[model samples]
Target: MGTPVLFIHGLWLHASSWEPWVTRFQDEGYDAQAVGWPGDHDTVEESRRDPEAIADHGIDDVVEHVAGVIRGLPELPILVGHSFGGMIAQRLLGQDCARAAIAIDAAQIKGVLPLPLSALRATLPVFKNPANKHRAVSLTAEQFRFAFGNAVSEEESDQLFERWTIPAPGRPLFEAAAANFNPHSPAKVNTANQARGPLLLIASGKDHTVPETVTRATLKQYRHSEAVTDLETFPDRGHSLTIDSGWAEVADTCLKWLRGQSL
Candidate 1:
């Protein structure tokens, strides 16, 4: 059997956001599972109504959540995550909990420079509101389109905005923004750990939330994994690369990369 693959979704998204990728992986003979963050709702609408429930979820909580899922598997799984999930994947790898990891359009690690204008704009709304620091906030359709669905057709974008967009916890974002300077922050990942397994950092060239420059800067953290680190860039994709129209291509690329690894 192929190695197990565990998928982690980004902020404002549920495990169901990975439906297409999960199906694709399973068809290719891999055992796949999409685990939710603690207190994450099952649906977008449900989450929207109770955004506060997810507000306090921090990086440590997510790390423990994904780690628990990994422990349930008989073999070490390939951890795949996007945005916040990608951050958690990095932390998991640092702890030596996974056989392989793929971080797509992930957030910046400590010490990365050159934050992009697009990323700053995308985050302004959340950070501007002091209340958001301790609360969850749901984006409007327009906000969703700009942040996650800009690359898709209007119809598809609208459908995705309606179907997948939800309220997201704000604490993690606040914490991540201050991660580099805060020694007590849990959002910080030890990406320089040499013992961590193989890692693939996928950068979406057109991603407004995580610009290519920032992604490249983030690579420095993995310098210790020189022999095992691989970077791939998808020029036409956005932050929602895994759910966009060409999601299969991205998933296939990751599957192929994992196949070449020892795990």
Candidate 2:
């Protein structure tokens, strides 16, 4: 069988958000599947209609859920994750769950510092309300435009928001925010495992949620490991790097890297 590539999406997007990616990867001989967080609806419309279905899920919950998905695969697949999904990919890599992995505009895991002002502003929707930690949060169109659509045109921003955005659990955000301070935080990843396989961290130059500085800090932490870790930046992109019009550029970059690994 060909190598499987599992796509994991970040907050505000359902598993269906990865459908186009799945098709692209399949064309390249990858058995790609997009996995969802536990309790996530199958579609964005369902998620938006009943947002509370995803309430109170923490980082650990999602980590375990994705781990379960990996366990069911025939072979250890190439894990590709976006935003919070990127963080999950790193966690799974630490567990030796995949052949290789890619994290795009990923949220910071434990020990990564240098929080940029833009990242803070982008996530303010959840952090601004402490109660959101126990609830599901939905981004306003304006918030989405600023955070995920800043580099795109206004019309494209609105279209993306309407098509892909959905409610996301806030507990994971809270857990990540406290990861540095908490000794036993669930957001921790084993960055020193040589057997964790290759990893590529992709950063969007215009991403407010995860700036290039943040991804650079993450790469620095991985440098301590014997594992092959790499970083790439896509200029003029935002948090919507995987879904925007220029998504193929990012996808092609990842494909080139994966081809080099001979996976």
Candidate 3:
């Protein structure tokens, strides 16, 4: 057995989307697997066929679900998460559930103040309707293109959408949008935990869903901690950097950083 590495996908993407990264990490001698959210199905088709199962699951639900999986592992795993999954990874790491965490384009936590207009547009599908808060909402191909594939070609974006996109719960987004105003927001992460494991923050320069400013804001939240906190940026990449043809580069970067950390 080797040090476990867990991959967490954000909304609109299936767990299987991390398969390539899993293989890459496994080839490098790490035990890697992508775990879905609490109500997610084992397969994309099954999840798409049954949207109710994935609806209404909030940030707390995902955190507890992944935390349970980590608790059952033989050793504390390294969490590598995308978007909202990134937020979940940080939350779990703060609780001392993992050895380290890599949060890529993580959603805005409670203390982050920047709100780029592009981010607002990317998530408009859910915010346009208050009722969506308790339902499963999916993005149109065009919307997916704008939010996740803007850095890639239209053809590649459509292909990725067809292969991995799925309906996502609107609760987490709602929770995050209202975090600053809520006292006990689920979007909050304990970034000041000096005793926690190393944390890595990855950002895409052209990400409309989570702008670089937002990721930068996320890093500042940990200013109170003296632990190993690092930031990496892929200036030419977009939110789909993890699932597109260029994923190997990002995965390799992650592997290199982990080895450097002696994980």
Candidate 4:
């Protein structure tokens, strides 16, 4: 196999949503695989049939899951993650176990203070109920449109939602919501690890879930580290940039960015 490239999908989207990206990366001669969170089913129908397996998982649970997967790989791999998955990649990268990482529309990590209203509204489905902390929450098609597909059209957004949506654990959202106040928050990443691999943070301007401001704030957290960290923004895109009609454009950008890397 060529260099290992691990794909991590965020909440609400099944791991299979990265199928396109996995195929694309493989075509370029990299060995790629997308690993799901704990309890994630192999397919959307299976996941939908039993959401309990995918519920109640928090940020630390996911990070540890991916880390265990890495320990089984032939070598340390490049981590390419979206949304919460991206945040997971950052945590793993800090452990010096990855070659590099690309976090696209990643969730807000600890120390990132600017909480955009759109982000809060996007997560309102889970936050509205304090008890949801231990439950799995699914987004309605309309909520999906608002949080992910707003940059695209009504038709495509609905189609995407129907094709890829799944119920996600509310625990991570609750943990992240109070990360700033929690001393031992699982949402924290070791941004000061100077020996960590290169990191590429991607942000979409129109994203309601993880706004550009959040990504920028995330970058500020890495300032104390001498490690390589870069930020890229797509001004016209939304949170769905990774799984939308123009996924190839975003995928290509990521591929091009990696060309400069020593890997």
Candidate 5:
């Protein structure tokens, strides 16, 4: 049987966003599927039409939801996640849920130090509003441009925002922000677990939401683990690296890395 690959989408994106990558992986002989965030809309248009459908959910909800999907799979899949999904991947890995995992511009997990100014600015819309803790939040085109399309052109940024952006639950953002302070925070990951398997943290050099320093911090925290944890940088890329025109490059890089690991 072919190796399994599970794709997890980040905030504001549906599983459909990974369609191209799924196709690419299938052609390369991997059994791949894109799993949605719990309560996520079935389509981007549906999400745009009624963003409230995905409201009020938090990090723990998503982490367990995806873990259930992975547990039912025939084999321990190679997990790939973006943004918040990346955090979920790491969480799953912490529990030894996958054979290997890749986190692309992953949202900050507990222990990732010194949150960058760009990440704070990128998340201001949600964090600034206390009410957002229980609500979903949408980004304006300008905000999306600043956060996800900074490395792309103005025209391209507008187009990308129009096509891909959607409202996202703000609860996870709140939980992640308060994780370090709360010992029982759901945002925590078991980075010290040797059984967590191999991990690759991919950072977008130009990403405003998950800067290189953030990924570097995560890499440092994972260094004590017996499992292999490595970092890779894709310069000139933004947080939208997985959905941008150069997405194939990211996919190919992942494929190459997986092959090297014999996964």
Candidate 6:
């Protein structure tokens, strides 16, 4: 049988964001599981009303949560994550918790350079208000469109906003911004480990949060895994690549890459 796949989602999104990809992977003979971030609600609307439930969740908490889930699996799963979820996946890999990992539009870990303007713009809202650091905040339709669905059509973007966007924990964002400067920050993942299994970094060309340059720059830190490191780029995809119109293509590409690995 093919290896089990564990999916982790980014901030403001639930595990349901991976439903389509889970189906695709299952069809390819893989067992797939989608895990929610700590305090993630069952629905976007529900999460919107009780945003506080997700407000205090931090990087360390999320990493421990995902690790707990991984411990229950029969074998090490192929880990797939997006944005903040990608950051957590890297932490899991550094802890020797996964068989392989694919980070799509991943957030910046320690030692990654070249922060993009788009990333700053996307994060400006969180930094604008100090209270946002301890509170969860939901985006308006226009805000979500600009930050996440810019590459998709108006109708599709609207639909996606209605279905997926939620009040995300601001603490993680605050922590991520300050990670490089903080010596004791848990937001930093160890990428120098040579035995962390195969790591693939996928960057979306149109992604505003994690641009191509930033993603490529982050890969350079894994010098220990020179032969195992891989990078792939998908043009015309924004930050919401997994839930966008052409998500199947992205999932298919990831499935193929995972299939080629030793796991």
Each model's lDDT comes to 0.83, 0.91, 0.95, 0.94, 0.89, 0.85
Write candidate 3's Cα lDDT for 1-263 as tens digits. Answer: 88999999999999999999999999988889999997789988998999999999999999989988888899999999999999999999998999999999999999999999999999999999999999999999999999999999999999999999999999999999999999899988888899999999999999999999999999999999999999999999999999999999999899989989998
Displacement of the residue 64 alpha carbon in candidate 1, Å: 1.4
Residue pairs with backbone atoms closer than 3 Å in model 3 (clashes): none
The 10-residue segment with the lowest total lDDT in model 1? 218-227
lDDT of 6 by residue, 58-171 (tens): 889999999898888889988999999888888898888998889999988877868888888887778789889898877778777777888998789889988888888888
Error of 5 at 261 (Å): 0.5
Residue 251 of model 5, lDDT score: 95
Residue 204 of model 6, lDDT score: 89
User: Which run of 10 residues does model 6 get worst, by summed lDDT?
Assistant: 220-229
Q: Candidate 6, residue 63: CA error in Å?
A: 0.4
Clashing pairs in 5: none
* lDDT comparison, 1 vs 3, better candidate: 3
Task: Pick out the ten consecutive residues of candidate 3 with the lowest summed lDDT.
Answer: 38-47
The Cα error of candidate 5 at residue 16, in Å, is: 1.3
For model 2, state the Cα shift of residue 257 in Å.
0.5
TM-score for each model? 0.95, 0.98, 0.99, 0.99, 0.97, 0.96
Expressed as tens digits, the lDDT of each residue in 100-196 for candidate 4 is 9999999999999999899999999999999999999999999999999999999999999999999999999999989999999999999999999
Query: Clashing residue pairs, candidate 6?
Result: none
Evaluate model 2: give its lDDT: 0.91
Top model by lDDT, which number? 3
- Stretches > 4 Å off in candidate 3: none
lDDT of 1 by residue, 13-81 (tens): 878989998889999888998988877887766777777778878778888988888988899888999
Please tell me which model should have the higher TM-score, number 2 or number 6.
2
lDDT of 5 at 225: 86
Ordering by lDDT: 3, 4, 2, 5, 6, 1
